[model samples]
Target chain A: MVDSVTTINSDGSRYFLYPADARGRFSLARRLSAYGLIVVYLLLPWIPVGGHPAVFIDIAERRFHFLGYTLAAQDTWLLFFGVSGLGFALFFLTALFGRLWCGWACPQTVFLDHVFRRIERWLEGDAVARRALQLAPMGPSKFARRAVKHLLYFFASLLITHLFLAYFVSLPELWLFMRAAPGEHWAAFLFVFIAAGLLYFNFAWFREQLCIVICPYGRLQSALTDDHTLVIGYDARRGEPRGRAGTPAAGACIACNRCVQVCPTGIDIRHGLQLECIGCAACIDACDEVMTKIHRPLGLVRYDSLAGLTGGVTRWVRPRTILYGGLLLLGIIVATFAFSSVQPANFLIYRMSGAAYFVGAEEVRDQFMVRIVNKRPTPATFTVSLEGLPAGMRQTGFLAPVTLAAQEELVSPLILLIDRKYYHGAFKFTVKVADAARTFSLARSVEFMGPDANLLTEDDHEKHRHR
Target chain B: MNSQPQPPHGPEAEPALRPHSYDGIREYDQRLPNWWLNTLYGAIVFWIAYWFVYMIAGLVPSDGAQVDAAMARIEATKMASSIDVTNDDKFWEMSTNPVFVEAGKQTYNSLCFPCHLASLRGKSENPTAIGPDLTDTAWIHGGTPKEMYVTIKNGVIAKGMPAWDPVIGQKKASEVLAYILSYHKKGGTITLQAP
Candidate 1:
């Protein structure tokens, strides 16, 4: 009832009548808007802020910043979990809805429907012009139209290629190379150039073949979907017992096949659910317009499950969806906790050097190196000390202590010397580092290596100590 | 339904395909396209190359190893810069003078106070458990200055303590050693023990 009106243009002319096959629904401007949206999307990753590349996957640096968070190499497991969670989420959604992602949000489908379709309409005219032009004989006018179409395609393709590069290589670097002479950046320029041409050719010409054969998601739909899953399906029961409403027998499906015509994937919804149907709702829009004209209820062709059409409830809360959602929620909580609990930096402890060996006097000397990592966005200072060392052992590295710059690592090594009389056995020492205020201590343990022979016997040590 | 007569057919005409057409759309069996197959093969090739370069070559170390190596390098480099003549004064200075003890205490507070605490209290989270409780008499390593110096220099790697040979030289080790020894003879209530 919300959209139950069926009216037409001014005048009582039947020329604009509705029940006739709906033609010229999509105008030239509307089509171009679709193409322009894609161009804008492709260009976003390359647009830079400040000197930094807007999006960088500097895997070599072991630091990747997507929006702004600098994910270090240590966060690789988090990446793994994140990707897995995403993959499962996609699977669950697809299993329940049947190519909903492909229809509405997939980059591939959006670009093809909007960009490629617009370009095609521009070159060959509307659907009628396109069909007529296909049968037209070779002539200067035809050649000119064809040439213009392809030239635009190539230009659009070039833009796509550059944007893809920006996603990986970062926009700032690309801009620097672009600003230089062609000779200076021939390698980069050439790669982007070829990439654009390839993308253009793929989206412009190859088109629907990508969904049918290349995409695994389409193939996996059969495995993911069931009778209860909703998809763009023709109500074969109603549509089958179908004929023109104005005709002698009016079940109201005149079988005009306009739904098939507008489908980007070139599949007929009337044939029931097919993998080729991206569920773009183009057919729905087309059929709805037809129904309105023919004075029949809308939704003769609509999103519905096989079970629903077969006189069963749609069942909004399926068991599979609930299970998948629970797993996804659990994964999200774990990932959140892992991310929050991570220390902002590394904690380190080192043995002092030159204390490793004893001189002719039989003194043992060894050396050590200690380092601290500051993972904050600003500079931080930390105090370092040794713990769990034997009663007499201590650390000797710092005089004024050290401060680490933002994302910096500071290393300091110390030396320890032991008299032969004190040489007992290997002992463990714990190293503790704290921020300048000594509020939080990050601790680790290390051993003090020394000769066991010089250690006083247990009884001797006790006797000597008592004195 | 019979308003229009059927058109004449040629001798090789095929039978009407029934039960198939919905609103005049005839289904035809068409195989998958060639371009798709080619692209899939191309992706496989790219994947193989990536796998070889990144996984088989061992070019990238694990994240944990990288962190450990980075800390070790920093420690080594720092110790190399601090070696000097400070050890001789400590050896001869008899270090028991309150002047020396106060100086040592200042140094300890500034440098070691974070882990050991201003009260010589031990922290629980220290990975190495570096500073023992000064109040306890358990001298796992002897309480002598020389023993303290050696323990400071040659850190135990297995327990997470780095050898500080690169940051502090032999001389600085001795000064800190003298500082620790001063604590031993002084009538301080602090004792070394477990936290």
Candidate 2:
């Protein structure tokens, strides 16, 4: 309402932006970033780290593998902290540099500006030829070119889909899926098929509408950015009341509109910051190229913070940035400590379902059930024994080791038999369990009722015989 | 009657296709991206090929059939490695063999000894043993092998005898029954504590 700039109209007609090709210092950096990001996206799923995919999510088993470390379903808290750390990092970056990610690093912009543009320029020629071809009459040459271009887009979408699917399924399993019959894996097939179609639409048509209308990350800009946030800005004060070059005592700007033509989202930078700008530095490149021809100094459109534009110093350190940084560091420390101390198997012991305790001729017996879960991804053998067996207590009734597979639990019956003489009130002992190799051990304490020890003596055997 | 003239595409160099003005702004009729149109056409082509192989020619099996086949393969691997004690007739035949009795004695000592005692007399002082005396000529249920096998498998619930089939599996359960039957036929006088 303030500047009379609207992107989507009620009439359903939109002005298309055709940014001319630009080569500059920033352009080189943006291009390199685009290549690096695309490579990471494509190759991350294929590489193996510690016998696992570098990053994989096995949804069926609720396991996540990140850089060789595996986190089971119970360890979901670690994943939550990891996500929060990423969020804090984003906040910190936004506070220092306004919308830098949206311009140079965002996938939407990178694909459109780097990949799709190169494809477009290679086939349809520059901006002028592209516009002419659109208005030109239908012909065989035009149809052939259109067909080839579309074919390339379809195949490109399929490649991207394959790379995307690698993050969820393991490599060998994915290979098996690829070799399997289509109907056998119809669910996976349909997912990739539909995803390819969507990617094609996004890269080819949706373009800036994805960034301008949908991405809520941009909406956070207003709240996150302060006066010190560096953004691509045009110095309107010195360049206004514009005129053609060489007019006596005229303002520096010639009203060329080259900056507008070079913008990915077609907005004149001279109108100040707008939501559609994206801060790509394309206008800066275009303006500088023009300034060189006109024998004037460059930097008409440049990276300047709000304070700098208003003749004030740009402050780099602020309270908001410090808070986000501190939180991110704290999340990493706490998550690492918790992950290291997690138990491999959870042990629980309780009295058997039937009787509490029973006295035999020479011994007292209490039935119990030891429940154990093997948390590893492989089978483990466990031997259970009673620790602190005061004087004469023995483990009886199936004194053998048990083996359980991944995530499997056992509720085997156990009976603790202690000599009647050793029976006393409130005796404490621990149920100790270790793997066959004694690699690890777990202990839990349980209590049993007994006759008073003081009453016991050489006459205890006589009392046992009477019972 | 006056016919309206068509609007002109604003100075062809710019992005505008028509000269119609809205808030003093111009809009061009930009052709849809060639890649987008091609992708739609490609999808149509792909769907046709998929329909031919998966629907018409029937190259892929139905989901249910595929799953059933995979399940059978897994079950077969597990079945081949263990004794098929599920067949009660075959298990009864095997129970009469000398090898089964030998194995059965080991199972009885480990599992049945606590209640029946090494003496097989089923005698205990405090709380009294729940297991019936195995040497008695009068069987609690029946003296027949089938009756004893069923007793071991199903257990006498009211007498606090938990079913052994689930805990030790069918093979071991059959063996334990064989061990008890051996003593019943011989009327062994073995004693643990002279009781």
Candidate 3:
């Protein structure tokens, strides 16, 4: 088969295919794994952990609830770590085995190969029937089948869109949105329909083009793979010098072309290490079946590195693999450290925006606004008191023991009054907050207008003599 | 199974076409795909350019700038209009306007309420309360409305008062001045709140 990404068949005709269904141990293994993955994807959104949806990323409110932990928008850096970790892992895996992800668990491949293809096969029958149906003229019977198939595609697309939306919105919010009139949330309405359209287009039309042309991972795998990297390939050394029916051949290859017909990405395995090979092991199963029928030794096409085929050794502890592995480990460690030590509370103090310092009848006053974020699972009630402050520095507003709900943020206004005796210039003091149970405490220091020791040595004799 | 394994490529007359073995796999002497190389190098070049434009040159603001911009957005959204104290015309015009004075009063009450007291009637005998009363004719720095505006904008450094213009922005300073001037008592009855 031609390796080039084109719609034309090798015989120079339009290539529209219903690839012959693969029935091998590898195919069975993949189908079972896809079932498990699809179940997990469907169930994750509804599962509640620590009173939050399992993996909700509430962008509007700036809160991410991952598994059992709730993180604020301030912790967005963690997402960077998570994404980079995935990237590094991909690199490491690609260096070890070529295109393993593209075939087995890639979302695009999984949905099309396992979900969409199954539905198509069940509806239209096998490869011969599917091809015949496509060629047949429009009639009542055909129109009815076509309509039902498209309706099923629409429903499947809808289900996928629901799952995708559930990640950003809580299950309850999603239900509410669903029950409301579409016009109320115009943007969301548009997004859901647009996503469905894209999914339909991808599954029905784009298909293998996603792997052959659009996917950067295929290109990346080629770049990362050396001769030692493992990949599924036909053993051209054993399988070559094709044997025709009723003709003796030097090589084992019977030239039945079962491997070519079973391929998903539509590439011949005999062509050494093409970019389109997804390492799904479908051809290996098909070739092994053919070899079994011919009463020959198995593994005409198999999972092996080019080095292994060429009489070389495979090194698992190479420098490039170790480098990728080391970085992946480091990323995980740093992420764990950060997640474990996430601050339970964050506090900030700003001198009130408008006025400088106020002179009261009995004291010199300075107003401040305190902002606090409760970064814990439970509701927090904390009493704010001043530290490193001289005696007679009292506060009136904001009765102590401020309470906030779980993941709540509060801004409080307060007045600090220094008794007439202690109006020192810019006195430094700490604003401390302690939980009512005294379980935890956080502090932030601030400057207030108070007696400056410099006042005693004032060169401003006129103001000093008046005092 | 042949007696010995044979290489896949046909007998190559040209050295360039000959498949060389490394670690057992036959290595085809081919360069990496252009797309992959371009993308890898593009990210490197982009990162350097990003560093030059944002971090080193400071053309784009960092985290602090983002916070400041957010604050400025909030400031713009506030009930009061953007105050321009740089121009003397806008300063005095806003000072006399009742609306500006009202906005200033709101700002003063929240920001200055801790020290100045809600009444704006300061005490002279006690050092802590010894701040000159706004209502009283006697002025520590200058008595005129313009002088008070300047003093409030650029505070008396020797004294504890901070320069509010930079912190609260200039227009708000003029508003505070207007609020203060509105009650610059001309020997009237002291309108003090109950203490």
Candidate 4:
């Protein structure tokens, strides 16, 4: 067992690993799931759901569409729920199953292990042959293999990044941008190329180093996990005092080191659970394969908790897991409620850029600018009305239902006047905006400013006395 | 599993620990990967070059200068699109055009209708309206196109008319004037009256 990072040499140089292939149930299941995830990633921009791509962001228009639901810029606060909900979900999963996301779902692990490594394995053969090719001096055959492998990696990266861009710009717009001159859409062009370059650099060479050295989730394992967390661990009780088969006083382990050979991060699983373990179960599969061949029971190295490996029962319902799960449930509920509450339009009522209120000869008036924004994809007619206003109050502008085009916004004056007989002190009233069909409504409480009622009455009495 | 040479301390030798211990926990001082070190060095070099170019050599324009240039460009565009407010004939011509009048009427109804009334007859139609009658031959602030334009652009502040030029730009202000002119004849009687 090495005390330091296994993938880094004592001299600080990179020790590249070529993990041997382990063909077993876990590996096969992982491969199928990875393929499913990749297909979903590629098809999201192609499948149209409710007139838009299934997951279009539409950054230029500031509308984010997921499935059929759309969120306008005014609904940006909902992003807090979306982000926090994902965070709590990750925390809950991590507390229950150690590094399951890193092994099965992380884009870095998925692309590197399945796509890039598969390409390398096909071109340069298995672990032993790949290592030999790496050590061999430059030759025509070796050069051709390396060049072709790198070319394929680059193209794969470009494909991934282009699809990523399509999520924001939509597929048709991305196609237009691609066909246009680079100078015409230089920002998007530069973004795509830069992203593709970074992805190629990551998947091609920076494999397990990302999980071991860079990923914050891997670093968070110690804090998020405990003895009850399911993890990939070796059974020291069964596999200790390793020796050849049929040797007396030796445990079941033949000291074959098959588990270490298949480890992508180059760590010995028999040394116990380490930070480098991504829970890929490669070591488990390798050990199981060897145990079966030797006519012994499988699972010398297997998925179990620290307690389970030590012959203790694993507690599945711990306090840590319960807290995380509860939080996650709360987040989901709140996010669902918040998303449903988002209205199809936004409105703001602000005092106009003059006096707060004007007192005329026979009336008291207030001027306001009502800005209405229609966030829906279709034109909507909205009816504006004053609620809880005193009698004899007059409202001008928005006398009829105003119709706004798709995603259009309009700012217009709204004037309210009261006859001297009905003049009252400054008061608060509600400005109600409802759809023409009265399906949904939004209201903002606005204060109508005016002079004191007694002051207006005093002026009237003074004028009357003088007359 | 290749037969690579082990470190000089032997395969079973443990890594040496650092001198300091915090709360019963000690750390191993391992070397950072050469690739990570190279990235750090690259960032330092980039920072030095950026500092020299932007701060010392002044090769790229400062952020303030860039903002100023952008603002200047926007001002130039606004000036180019603005109508000639001083031209009386242009205002009369625009009043005769239905396109200008329609756009102006929309703006007027949305903003000016409360005080002036939708019919543009202010107190004449409704005695308690805020503004004076616009359709009348008598003019409080001169009734000619240019005078009326001045009155609309820079408002009569004492009488509660807001300066429309800043609220709506010069173009929309002129459009509003065109809509008002559509109600009157060019050579009609004009009598200046006291407020």
Best by TM-score: 4
**Winner by DockQ:** 4
Query: Each model's DockQ?
Result: 0.04, 0.07, 0.06, 0.46
lDDT string, candidate 3, B62-158, tens digits = 9898999999988777636654434555555666689988999977865564445567775543334434567665677766555667778777654
lDDT string, candidate 2, B141-182, tens digits: 655666667777776654445567766776787787776666
Q: What interface-residue Cα RMSD does candidate 4 give after superposition? A: 3.1
Candidate 2: count the clashes. 2
Tens digits of lDDT, candidate 1, A282-347? 777778887887777888778788788666777757877787777778888888898776665677
Which has the higher lDDT value, candidate number 1 or candidate number 4?
4
Instruction: Rank candidates, TM-score, best first.
Output: 4, 2, 3, 1
Could you give the interface RMSD of each candidate, to one decimal?
17.7, 11.8, 11.0, 3.1
User: For each candidate, what is the lDDT?
Assistant: 0.62, 0.72, 0.73, 0.89
lDDT of 4: 0.89
DockQ-based class of model 3: incorrect
Candidate 3 runs further than 4 Å off: A1-3, A6-14, A244-249, A358-365, A383-399, A417-445, A449-467, B1-195
Where does candidate 4 stray beyond 4 Å?
B1-10, B16-27, B117-138, B156-160
CAPRI-wise, candidate 1 is incorrect
TM-score of chain A of 1: 0.80
**Consecutive 10-residue window with the lowest summed lDDT within model 3 chain A:** A3-12
